[model samples]
Target: MVQLSLPLKWVALAVYFGTMSTSVLAFPQYQSLAGLSERELKEALPKLTPRLPTPPPRPEVYQGAKLVDDAAHPWRAPRAGDQRGPCPGLNTLANHGYLPRDGVASPAQIIAASMAGFNMDLQGASIATYVGHLLDGNLVTDLVSIGGKTPKTGPDPPGNGLVSGIRTHGTFEGDASITRGDDYFGDNFNFNQQLFDQLKDYMNRYGNGYYNLTVAREIRYQRIKQSIATNPTFELVGHRHFTAFGEAVFSTNMWVDGRVKGPLENHVTQEAAEAFFKNMRYPRGFFRASKPGSATNDQLQFVLGTDSSRPGHFPGKNVNGTNSFTIDHSQGSVADFCAFYTYFVGTRIKNLYPNPTGVLRRNLIINIEYFYGSRPPGIECTKVYPYGQL
Candidate 1:
């Protein structure tokens, strides 16, 4: 090669040395271009380490009374031994001398005596009309229709009798006849007469006059007791003694819708009645707000009539001067008029809101009445029963 200039030779030497030094420092065998250790390289590299997701928040805890879970209902199979008979409210009534003091008093006798204490008889004419409707064949026909079976002339098996239909009616309607009827029978008389006429017609069409009065009465008594024993209100009654507070709400002359008659026909609207019944749960804020020493205003227990009647607020239907069977307000002397009353009261009290604190709230009683043949406008009946009234 030709001889190189001085600067060119120096440049060639410098390039050769730079390349050698870079190779020695780079640590190529370790896959490190920066001459770093494994730990240093890892630290210098952009880290993509895996991580767990953040957890969600917890649910708020209720501080007031404990709720009765689905399994705690008294009527559920294998009922607790303490769950028999009327709730503790009945016993409390006996203890306070409002009812019979005899230890041997049956629930039926106690209920009868309680009705008598109000100057009302279970066999009064109003009650009798309701009883007649129950015994009438129309109720059975309605049940048979609902069951998709033809009405048979004779009774079938014991459990498959006309009572089965009544039970279905109670279940399908959420036992609303107990409370909503108060508005109808307590206020509307013409509607009540219309209901009675319909019942008579139903009886004439389907009644065979074969059902025994004594048997029917006993069945009614048992059914009423069972309804009371299994109600959520009855459970609340067990937790608190209401009589100590000297409070009670007596709702009179309630009625149910006639068979084949509902809201569409301007009779007790089936939809309205069902909606009212479905909403019979314990009042809102009852648990969290009803603790003893708390200033919460609670509801009073209800005693209402359970007779069938025409719709209280009928729309697009003419019910004036109609012969619908309403609570027989005419039968003033005999308790027959009052029989339906007892049933209604019994069922209503059976459905009180559950007591979260296992104690009754005090100073709350709401009596829904026609007072002057009409409910006072804008007044709402409280849903909670006083702790002690069963």
Candidate 2:
């Protein structure tokens, strides 16, 4: 759907010499604040921050477990032409008609649908949606295929890789996925029964039948070990390092019956988990979280942590051969968003965009701020501006 492309409003300032880079940049109507005049950006110092995209208004109170996939939003199996992906969360959204069932969606549609359908927090939804859009979406069309590369997403942006959907390895999706295989194994999006079995096993052993923080960490640690032992190209660096934990938290929390408890309560039964992960359907009468929620920096630390003595605790790569990983202490961990942001924009984005100007450059500036500003409270990370100011 070409829904979010609003016409850019051009304005002239006599004092400013340079023309406003003829960048025909576009964002959702709610995000008009992010696309500022360079002069305005310069004038407004630390205050010129991107506002979180707010979803449609809702009832004040928590409406416990109702039919989320009701008559209005029914679940349907994906047809042959439909796209599905590594993230079961988005897949479920599409399956339930919260997103376009065809699998192509704009960042705004994704953000709104995700929040309205699941009560996802603005920060959490914005970060995930824009990351997918910026890295894997077609900026010209403002479309992202939730699954594999498809012409339905429209042509690739001039030189920014293939614009090959979220399933592209190491972009937004990466290794140690609880229910999916690494791209090295050939199919990264398809559900991996073997890995799911391991996940269930961890819940049985650690969480006593619930997927809590303890089960989350144990399963996460075990999965990394499995990948290191088996896969030839096992790399957990950059965004994957933190996103790995965020995904774990999503699984551990997303499908739970909200009537039971709180914002980030960890009590997802295997049945609820199985329903979402495998069937792409909610457990009947499912209610979303009492409040919008997701993992915080402290929560992420607890979920990603393991015994320091373990073999695969630190990030590394196999320079010599399989299993011959050299510890990459320089890559840093989820605890440090500053380093992650710096590395992500400075190195990662720069590779995709060797020299971005015009609309692309301005969009990059907006997206990264969405990422860092959402960092959990008490996480003292100074923002990194790789694209220079506005």
Candidate 3:
């Protein structure tokens, strides 16, 4: 082996050092890994509005109004003479008697120690659906009599036992319309008498006995009678009333409102129900329509329609993934409820929440026929005059 001298070894080491330095200098520039660009956000967000704090989720109990329970709603079959006594929904509260049977309430126990229950449901439904329920459930069935086996007939033939054919449209021009009658059963006062009787029944069942029940009943009847005389028939068909007991199905399609060629006020005519269903093609899948000015995820929906062929239609998709059609109580009209509640409580809510200038003040009413039908079991408008087919 040839021995390398110390001087050569030193030179070789220097050469090695130079190669390492040169290799390091040839490395690529220090670039960062890909990242979100500042411009990306600027281009993405269109505009920023001051986010208003969402109103606290509806309270469990506002005054005496009860919050609607999703689970309990479908089970709330109306308990008229068929079932008799207080409804299961009300029975839940009555079992304890609106307040605790055992202990003190009010200052010490303001909140219900038990489940907060109202004689009528207050918060669960949309203003429209509730109104529909009120008209179909309360006014036509409970309020009116139309006594005798001589079935209430129109120009059209009466078909099946299923609830069908609502007189949603048409003016209250003649004696035939519910507007003219005072009682639902019997020829006497027509719907008017039935209305009084039902009011009496509500007082007996739900009233706290704050005032003379009979006198109060007379006062309430007068208000309804006057309302029918003054306003359009639709006004009598209060929106909240329909939603309360009527078979309602709502869709989440935000565009549904915008699709209207005319203003929304005009759009909610008698034909509106038919028009809305006609347009949607009866969507079956889970769809979401946001309430106006809500966040993207704040989607809403309702059942498409009810099968009046039976008292309870099979629950279906409500634009949301949840089953849509659900009803346990006979729909009660907000107008009637308002009248009833006010008579009991001794004042109206509108008196408390008055509207200011330019803004319209709304007195809640039921769009009864809109939900199911204004007619009896055999001849409901829902049966003959359906949304799309009609």
Candidate 4:
């Protein structure tokens, strides 16, 4: 080799030393820097960018349980053309004379017919005890004191007291002493007795003994209907529909019962009642307790009827206004006589039936009349002049 200048020699020494230092630090535990060639040193040294650590075999992302759709689940919306009108069951009953073919009947008439069919009695001796036990034992004492007059009782009894000599028929005709009956009576008597006991205990313990008279009447009829309306062939007469109605009625009664010791007392507001009614559901063709808050794809579209908001009406007044009635009533004084009868007769066709495809079926008309009132007046007749007009 030729002799090199001093500066060039120094530069070559520095380069050699720097390369050696890098190799020595690259892997301290393994080979020496002096043992490796330049190419080998370059291969052995650590990368400045660190080779990204081989990316740690990317972990898989976890997904939750997959959803599965089923028949009962995901509440399918109602379909188009699913809504219907008044049930056809009413016509069937009319043809059989179980109800009037004219489609006109009063609540009293309906009550009478149902009573006759079932052999129930409202005026029987047990009624006083039953009614008294519903509100208070004192009520029985008061009734007996006043010669069979319904006692002015409740959280706030009516000023006029009960219409004298009027009593409500229970669902069963059994003697209170009897424990059971042959068919529905066995269960029904127990059910009614339990209901009475529960109501009495509730009123005595938690409520003010004041019953909501109008609501009580409604409950009585509802209970009666529930007990009697169980003919499989009869559309309106089914356990399911009656059960639903009874539930609604019971709920309302409980609501009123709660108010007995609270702020509202027997004065359940119409707004409140309507709200409760709006939320009620029943079998097909029966009334929906309330207007549906929302619409679904399969919801039936039908008119309930005109909302009658008369201020001075009997039940309406009791619920919305200051007027209150005692448990007693002369038969003709109750305004809902026609409305109730018509509702029972008209809504008979809404019984639940099997669908061929097993899909949800729609009721024809919304049975709002039970909660509100009936339309077209259940019965209307004009006097005719046989000879000359008077």
- Candidate achieving the largest lDDT: 2
Residue 239 of model 3, lDDT score: 26
Task: Residues 7-101, candidate 3: write the lDDT tens digits.
Answer: 99889999988776654332111110012133422321222121211111233433332232223332222233111111112222222334222
Residue 325 Cα positional deviation in candidate 4, in Å, after optimal superposition:
39
CA deviation > 4 Å runs, candidate 1: 1-64, 70-155, 158-327, 330-390
Best by TM-score: 2
Q: Mind giving the per-residue lDDT tens digits that candidate 4 earns over 253-281?
A: 22232213455543333333322222211
Quickly count the clashes in candidate 1: 40
**Model 1 poorest ten-residue lDDT run:** 238-247
User: Per-residue lDDT tens digits of candidate 2, residues 1-390?
Assistant: 444333322222422223222222212221112223454333322322333333323432553334466788888999997888888889999999999998877677887777767777767777787667666765434467787543322221112223267887777888878899888888888888888888888889988888888888888888888888788788877567767878888765457776776543668898888988778877887887666766766667787675676644666655665677666756565655667766766776666655555555666666666656555565666656678886
Q: Give me the overall lDDT of model 3.
A: 0.24
Minimal lDDT window, size 10, model 4: 355-364
Model 2 error, position 349 (Å): 0.7
Clashes of each: 40, 0, 62, 17
- TM-score of model 2 relative to the true fold? 0.77
